[model samples]
Target: MARHVLLVEDEANIVEAIRFILLRDGWSVSTHSNGATALDTIRSVKPDVIVLDVMLPNKSGFDILQDLRADPAIGNTPVLMLTARGQKKDRDTAMAFGANHFMTKPFSNSDVIDVITRLCDDPT
Candidate 1:
């Protein structure tokens, strides 16, 4: 089965970049820009991996991660949190909220593809 990836990011450029990278790597990529509706999209899509942005409209990625961790259905879904800040505090917060990995913005295409590939290979 093709691996599914849910990309929750507001920035258009980042979205396009990650989408292109993952798609080229043979992933089924779905995108959501609004954090408030992100959970609904996730539930509906049931993606194999999630690429989430830290700052979002309506709700923050931290809040969404907390909610996902609390839900039994999707609690174990691997999440890779993205942040433009690239600060230790931001990375630590993502870890505390149960994100499986953290990557800063302006990330290398190779890195994103490689990480997503690994996350998909991990057993759900």
Candidate 2:
């Protein structure tokens, strides 16, 4: 089965780039821009992986991750948190919220592919 990946990011260019690369790498990619509706989209899509942005319109990525962790149905879904800040605090917060992986903006395409692949492969 083709693995599904949902990208929740407001930046147009980043969304395009990640979508293109993931599609090229044989992933079924879905995207959402609004933080307000992100959780609803995620539950409906039930993607295998999620690439979430830290800075969003209505809610922050940290809040989203926390919510995901609290929900049993989608709690274990792998999440790769993205942050433009690139600060230790952001990374720490993501980990604390149960994100499987985290990446900063301007990340290499290979890194994104590799992390997603690894997360999918990991049984626990």
* Candidate with maximal TM-score: 2
TM-score of 2: 0.96
For model 2, name the residue pairs that clash.
none
- Stretches off by above 4 angstroms in model 2 are none
How many residue pairs clash in each candidate at the backbone level? Answer: 0, 0
Q: What C-alpha lDDT, on a 0 to 100 scale, does residue 19 get in candidate 2?
A: 97
Residue-wise lDDT of candidate 2 within 1-124, one digit each (tens)? 8999999999998999999999999999999999988999999999998899999999999999899889999888889889999889889989988888878878899999999988888825
> Worst 10-residue stretch by lDDT in candidate 2?
115-124
- Residue 81's lDDT within candidate 1 is 90
RMSD of 1: 1.3
| Reference-based TM-score of each model | 0.95, 0.96
Query: Deviation in angstroms for 65 in model 1?
Result: 0.3
Clashing pairs in 1: none
92 Cα displacement, candidate 2 (Å) = 1.0
